[model samples]
Target: MPDNREARAAARTDMIMRTTLALAQETGYAKLSIEAVAARAGVGKHTIYRRWPSKGLLFLDSLLSLNEPALDYPDTGDVMADLRRQIYAAVDLLTGPQWGPLYQALVGEAQHDPAVAAGLGERFIRPQTDKTVARLRAAQEQGQVAPGFDLDLAMSILSGPLYFRFLISQEPLTRDYVDRVLDALFAGMGPRGPADAPASA
Candidate 1:
């Protein structure tokens, strides 16, 4: 009986999240409301409220559920290749008609709402950052990356420009842009040679 209850709850939550995404895609974040989602999902608004404290968090979870598979890092032993593949996949998603605008709206909302910002960081940003740092650390351990630089900072450096272009500057974000960023990052982070070392400074 307990197992059955849990299954039903999980099914309901999935339905709610899917409904949220569908509504957000159709009506957009600015116009979407918990009441609408509750009505569409055939659940009480309290059910969503119990799961997610705010609309921002609910939307965040919904987007994550849909995009997690595409955003996951691939471990192919070639760190640069793996990173490139994952980043390209992200670019595709971020540039897609459905997710791109919704994510942009969420980011805008998070700017003024601390709860949303915190939720975004805790639920989405940190996990991605941790995965990136882990991958970089693995490369460092395998001698593919130079030692002594902070992997956490390295992860930020890798992602910073992309976000800047995507969200801030509103510049073109393309695979070529990703490749250039990777080229610069790897050139600096790759194992240094004696000749490449700094002379007496």
Candidate 2:
């Protein structure tokens, strides 16, 4: 039930997205360009421009297209257990063979480019953190977390260490690491004594 032009357009879009991601993974952000993408996709620069205004937009779109089905926000009631699952899934996605370099490239580019930073934060990072925060809020309501616990901080506590290991430490992000991160976050977010504080390790 699809029109000829629409079908062709969809196919072309798929071709362009795949080519864009392939080039991004191969050459990284600095060398990637609309011309290169169009050339690799066997399309015209004008064709790409008609769909996306800038190479950055195309880059973000390509990442989002690939990211759509991977990370599902969890809310299965048991706060620590759910967070563990979510964090492990995130670590897997970010440190996995196919997506790891691409994720690192996008995040690294975001550090240098304001547009990329905004795009990645607004499109990718914010949504993920928001989902995590929502999950925390639910846990707070259920009395699993402290009343004054900061959802934003909780999100950072959960995700920050993974990204640190992933991007900064350049170390292996493993299941054990995820477990430790969750353990530390739980200790911090759970009911604490007067002398309690978040564990950095």
Local distance difference test, per candidate? 0.89, 0.83
The TM-score values for the models, in the order shown, are 0.85, 0.86
lDDT of 2 by residue, 78-138 (tens): 9888877887788877777778888788788777778888988888888887788888898
Candidate 1 lDDT: 0.89
Global fold similarity of model 1 (TM-score): 0.85
Residue pairs clashing in model 1 are: none
In the order shown, the candidates' Cα RMSDs to the true structure are 2.4, 4.4
Which of the numbered candidates is closest to the native, going by highest lDDT?
1
* Candidate 2, superposed: residue stretches over 4 Å from native: 192-201
